[model samples]
Target: MANDTNEFWGKQAEPFRAFFDMQGEAMREMFGQMTPQGLSGAIPSATMAPGDMAEWAKVAGELQRMWLEFVQERAQKDMAGANPMDPAQWMLMTQSLAKQVPMAPLESAQKMAGDAMQMWQSVFTRFMAGGDPEDKPDLPRKDRRFADPAWQDHPAFALLHQTYLMLAEYFTKAARDVEGIAPDKRKQLEFATTMLVEAMSPDNFLLTNPVVMKRTIETKGQNLVRGMQHLINDLRRGQLTHTDSDAFTLGENLAATPGKVVHETPLYQLVQYSPSTEEVYETPLVIFPPWINRFYILDLTPKKSFIKWAVDQGITVFVVSWKSADASMKDVVWDDYIRSQIEAIDHVRDRLNVPSVHTIGYCVAGTTLAATLAVLARRDEADKVKSATFFTAQVDFEKSGELKTFIDDGQLEMIGKLSSEGYLDGRYLAATFNALRGKDLIWNYVVNNYLLGEDYPAFDLLHWNGDVTNLPAKWHRDYLRDLYRDNKLVVPDALSADGTPIDLTRIETPAYIQAGKEDHIAPAASVWRATRHFKGPVTFLLAGSGHIAGVVNPPAANKYQYWTGDSSAASLKEYVEGADEHPGSWWPHWLDWLESHGAKKVPAKGKRKPGGKGDKVIEDAPGRYVKTR
Candidate 1:
């Protein structure tokens, strides 16, 4: 192994020895001026000031300048066969650098500097001395951004790519090495820096990205012209274009689940879907999706729609399509939504003439549903809902994930100010969620649509994602304050809904809590905490993907895996270790669980009118409320 390592470095070191010597000399030169008294002098032993984001920009700019100068200046003179830079070639190094942690001890700084020097040597050697490129890419399997042939083959682009990745990684570590700050704040710093670094990746820019450059050359800059037009159109449309919006219509293609609006309120439209099976479960299923986005996500396409699948599997489905809240709705609170939920359940029960309905909530709606159930329990109406299922929902915010970054006092104050119109703008939530996975949701599109000028595809999911919705200001504030920030929802009676004190522990409703292993919005750990509150039979399942795709995974696709039978464990980690792994979607597992929990099959209703005569059809499914925006 040592011989192999030596052999590899020996080959690389031979051609760029002088280049390495000069670059190492350059680092030492900078280190003399930038050194901490010994390292903390230049780098503080404490965390950087929370407000001093400008400092990150400065440090990043300095590194960018030094690297560009070092490579452009001495490489041609020092390294054999090293390509000499032209004015056009120098333009390739274009992106501005971002911030990093401002502190480190002298020894650690020096050691990092040495490590960086070695990485610099290796990349330079590979770019300049290493002539022939390999047939396959050296990039991580997941990051396809640099898979283009020119990125690996061209010396200048290769230099930029390798250097950017190395620096991004180094700074990622440095961002986490902060001292004297709360773990949360440090994590915020690290997340901010990571996002900044990713945002400024070479591939994100047209000049630095080989694929975009190739497209430009091929199209004679027509791609840029078209992309600019797309930018202007999107800007005019008041949102980023994530999909070909014209490709799918609400009732025509997307959200095409057959159903009719049986009930309507100021808050929501209750769409009771037409049953697909001859005999369906006697107890109907009522879904309350998060108003943070539209409810169509549960019915994206027949291939992926969980609602459609459930209906086909002999379950009558009723979904609540929440109105896009505006000034009038801004005065509403969490209690109001709970009341509305109760009203919807009553209507479904009266129309179906059933005792109770199987209730389900996704994301924030699930969080609130837990509160509603508790309220029902407190009121001695526990039998109102036969079963409760939460999809990637966090009832207890104690173990909340990245979304908490937006809930601090300072940020909440800003949000309140922005919500002067009585409701928080949907765009704010859109931006917030986008930030959680900005590399994919935001930057990737920036590179593809704006830089590479690729036309956005017709994707049902992205369309739903882009279809943002507003939250009432007071309700939003109360939620952030009570549930997320204070974490009162899971603490017995710390919170209330519609004047009823919520005590989750008092609720004995059978629960099926499904969490995604990769869920960022509602992490598995946070979701798992709900199991402790359910006095009834609790079945916790962990799905394979993130919040959306994980839950939306269909059986026919046979994509991803799921885990079951580890609810006995105390934590998500322990549960995962002991859980039974199932191949494919968790849908089937959930189906069995629902039936076992008493989703009895009987003659299907709605041969003439959907939900029978009692439930009058107001309009078709994917009704007016969903089409409002």
Candidate 2:
């Protein structure tokens, strides 16, 4: 028994010892190469001599051969024990083998070659017939893919465009047909392939991109140098530095809404905007913005501010600005969030002398709000909430858009390992979100900031998107497990905070729910499912634009229209069929509904200064919590 124990422990220790020994050797080699004399000596002096292109080429070839050998050896070792024929091990073995095989890419290349032949033949025929080759394209073009006219007019560019499209299609089909692979893994593979294809687009390369080439020549390659500098800085920082952070000041330019920090906890700060109207509603409206991003999305600018709009409309608005979690707040769970939000609400109630306050929540905050309401209902404290409003929020995440592809048993377990360390870094969230719309978010930036070498314009929405906040490990894990992975939000008593099991059906608070028609985060159909869970009178609205634009839309803009209907329909399909289309922003309709439900116009009381029992005013609106990161 002693020998067996020793053998087991020795086996474990041996790996660590070997690893450290290898690491030490690697460190020594790295340091030796880093020395100025050693670095200079490593490069062949003959290759460095003027006009010695042949020597340089030989060196490059040798380096390439060495790299290939190393990769081949590593791959062989990795695949040594895998058996592709075994039924039980087939999926794993195939996945490993797939990494070594470029079958799909080869097929795509073949197809592109054939297509190129046909295009050249067509061009030759047009030229021989005394017809202009630039008159029209032989192949039909996709509006969204390669819309640039230069791509069609130039033979080289046309060939490149067609090749890319064909290759992208082939890769996509191959990704989907990755046989017997787990759904999450398959999705990840597909996403990765999509990103690669997008990155390889001719428009991203300075040589292939006429627009960028023109700009480079016009600017004397200064733009290219600047872009290289930006890339180096970002790599050094280990984060994609989006936006010129120096462009916008927090309080002055971005979240500049006039308000006071009436109360605060370690988790959040409650901002009560000073009323601009002579009279305010009897019931105060408290909003809980999603903690995934800063709260300033609601108060972006004076003209586009939702908080200011609400305040101006005779509503006393209070917003919960969540604190950015760090390592110290890793233990903060769902219960902590619920408790803190309730405490904030209690403070608002006491300060405003209002019995029941109207509650509003957006996205993740809305989900949390619903959970908190259910918990409160279980405790017989549901009367504190007069009415509830959800913006682009979903309690039922069955079909929660493309983002759902990242949620699975394997992925969640991996995420759990990372979460165990501390807070889930915000960069991961940003990257995932960016991946969802690669063309618009990721590839667009790659072209503009990295390729075109232009500074991103100081757009408030983009700034808000870039300013990410960390999520507590425990809280985020629970959220994913309950709401996302297991679909617990719709399951009665399946989700709970503290000791109480939350049942959404038990909460009879009249609710107003809005979902964006084009919301990729939370699909309107998924959000509409929440209507069935609520026992109270529910009003559902489907807005025209995407997640952020739908909610932040003001009436004056009249940009996107909306559809409104009572939640009497049996399904989302039925509701949409019967819903009435409104020509402008849904804010006026919401205000009217709110006023009818419980909000009453009254003579405005004296402005309440920022302070509360135990927790006094720490700072003005857009408080310290919002500025943590």
The numbered model that scores best in TM-score is 1
- If scored against the real structure, what TM-score would every candidate get? 0.81, 0.80
Q: For candidate 1, write residues 1-629 as lDDT tens digits.
A: 12422342333233334534544443343233322232223333256564433444344344444445544654564532211112121121111111122343222545556766776566566655544566333432224667777876776776666666665665666556656656666666566656656666767665466787688656644565566556545544446679988898998888998989989999999998888778888888999999788999999978888888998898989999999988889689988889989999999898878899999999999988888888899899989999999999988888898877666665677677768889887876776677678788777887788666788899999889888887899999988988898988877777777788888888799999999999988988899999887777788999999999899999999899999866868887888888888889999888888898785678875531384666557899989999876
Quantify all predictions' global Cα lDDT against the true fold.
Answer: 0.74, 0.72
Q: Please provide, for model 2 over 1-629, each residue's C-alpha lDDT reduced to its tens digit, 9 standing for 90 to 100.
A: 12422242233233224423443453343222323343234335554555443443443444344445544764776633322112233233223323322222223445556765775676555434545655643553353546766666666666556655655665566666655556655665566556555655667655566676677546544565567556545543435656886788888988898778877778888888877777888888889999888988999988889988998888889999999889899788888988877887788889878788999989999998998899889999989999999999989888776776666555566556556557887766776687678788876776788667898687888888878888998788778877887888888998778899989999798999999999999989889888889888898999999899999999889889999776788888888888899888999989988998775677665544334345356678888999998
Poorest stretch of ten by lDDT in candidate 1: 89-98
Candidate 2 local accuracy as lDDT? 0.72
Residue pairs clashing, model 1: 36-39, 36-41, 36-42, 37-41, 38-106, 39-106, 56-99, 335-498
